[model samples]
Target: MDELKGEWFETWFDTSYYHILYQNRDFTEAERFINNLLGYLDLPKNVNCLDLACGKGRHSVFINKKGFQVTGVDLSSNSIKEAKPFENETLSFDTHDMREVYKENTFDVVFNLFTSFGYFDDYDDNLKVLNSVNKMLVSEGLVVIDFMNADYTLDHLVEKEVKTLDGIDFNITKSYDGKHIFKNIDFTDQGKEFHFQEKVQAIKKEEFETLLEKTGFEIQNIYGDFSLAPFNKKESDRLIIIAKKK
Candidate 1:
């Protein structure tokens, strides 16, 4: 096993075990969220869309099915390779960093879903991602960022848990400081023990508003969850923001 240091995602996300650990993520819920978003936006057919940090391209495939020209990009080569099989006339997958602009003024919609942001330790890197998203979008183009509500998450924190899947026991421990949340995962497979960590910044609504405004995005709407309910800071399970390029 590799040492769990530096950027944890670079090693953890590239391994097959990472896929196994998260294979049970609710795809149905994600699909429904995409459907609701599409219905609300009512975008014209064949519009260009970019799925930022699109691991395995599930959401990208869903968007492509709805008649959009979708391009899914991720930093994980393993994920991009797995997503390539789904590519067709209007759908494509590539390996790219979200902090850099892949294409300028090209996409009608740019989606950064499933709390994919705030991985970098440096706060400025997160702003760079927003700038990249802004640069990629056309005039008045939409950017949907689905993030976790920091306050709610810290209030409802799960400190520890154990999950047994496929005959492997995963011991998970979670902790949150004022600035970031950390998940420490330890498990043994075939008599070998391994440990990994996931760290995400606890970005609040006000921070997002400031970042969007600074990036030239006008806030259009905010939702509390995948259901698209209006955001309530104290009670929402998720923070979903819809902003338009100014």
Candidate 2:
């Protein structure tokens, strides 16, 4: 279980490096994409929404502002701590492992966004997160999974790149496993070096569909991009799946 062989969660924090990435970000694209998704999903207001692995509460805040009651959970304390002050009556964030089963059938929607799946060393452990997602959804409840278009990503792979942000230099490399992509980033700053790694499940369209079916979810829709367009292999930047509890 090479995937389970690493401290992925801790390294995930280092890769995103909350304070830095957020500060350097351009939210315009994210704002547009999310707004489009909200329209496509057409979820009703006043519903309970759970954002699993909701890092830094960016999506949670956006959704809450759109009138949904949102609860966000992640495995990183640093993210939870960073997200806390942004919390309000309609939104909350906490630290929780996605692999654990939560209170069953309590949410109207459970969303795992931004390629957040496929990291555990054990394949079954990774699958368990889907079970947990299903358990959190009410009858006929919806779950939306938004991940990178693995095929597209693989084809467009950039083997190595150097990026300097906030005076830190990141030497990054990316490669693909059979079902996921592995990224290693070596960070250098002020004569010191730190390595960060992340593994994202590189599921084919059929693979994700099969996983959803096996998890007792009824496939409702699949989109290739955030604009809710039909899925086309050579044309989309994202793989967005919408499913409902059976």
Candidate 3:
């Protein structure tokens, strides 16, 4: 397949080193959240779902195991390639852009989890993703979005740190403008120096409310953390939204 055409996410997320850097991401916590969410959703046994920007399929694999037909798509071919080994009759992975619809009226649920959004510099592209997802869902289908609480994240931002993973010391610095968060990564590997950047919009809850409303979705529930508590803009670790297509 042709490589997914995009910007920084297209390049940075595809690198092997990216996986290495975040290798310790907590699958257990993710699974626990999934369990809580699925239990709350009580979706049918045979419902079809999509995992948008599903890098390497950790959550996709587990979601499929819970008896849903799951299709995982990511902008990175390398991530799709890594995720393909777990594919089966009911679970599949593909390389696709999130701003485009994969299939019209195809899925009963769509999951954009783990802060997999806010990559685009163009705000319209953000609308494109939600609009395409709106088109892709069946009537009243659910879309679950797990995103960072911009205020809380900024408040707790670590300005600088170095993490040594697999004998490579990754020097990292994080900064936030009034609009976006920037993480600068500098490191040396095999005597070659490298620098890569990650940028994400610090979209607030009110902005999301506007986005969902404009895109024909009804906000069903909003949670603060993985445990599914009520959202508090000041104290929450994550902004978990469950919206239903109108």
Q: Report the number of the highest-lDDT candidate.
A: 3
TM-score of 1: 0.97
* Residue-level lDDT tens digits of model 3 in 1-246: 123345779888988778889989899999999999999999889899999999999999999999999999999999999999999999999999999999999999999999999999998888999999999999999999999999899999999999999999989999998888999888888877887889999999999999999999999999999999999999999999999999
C-alpha local distance difference test of each model: 0.93, 0.81, 0.94
Q: Rank the candidates by lDDT, best first.
A: 3, 1, 2
Which stretches in model 2 have alpha-carbon errors above 4 Å? 1-6, 14-23
TM-score of 3: 0.97
Residues 179-217, candidate 1: write the lDDT tens digits.
889999899999888999999999999999999999999
Clashing pairs for model 2 are 3-121, 4-121, 179-202, 180-202
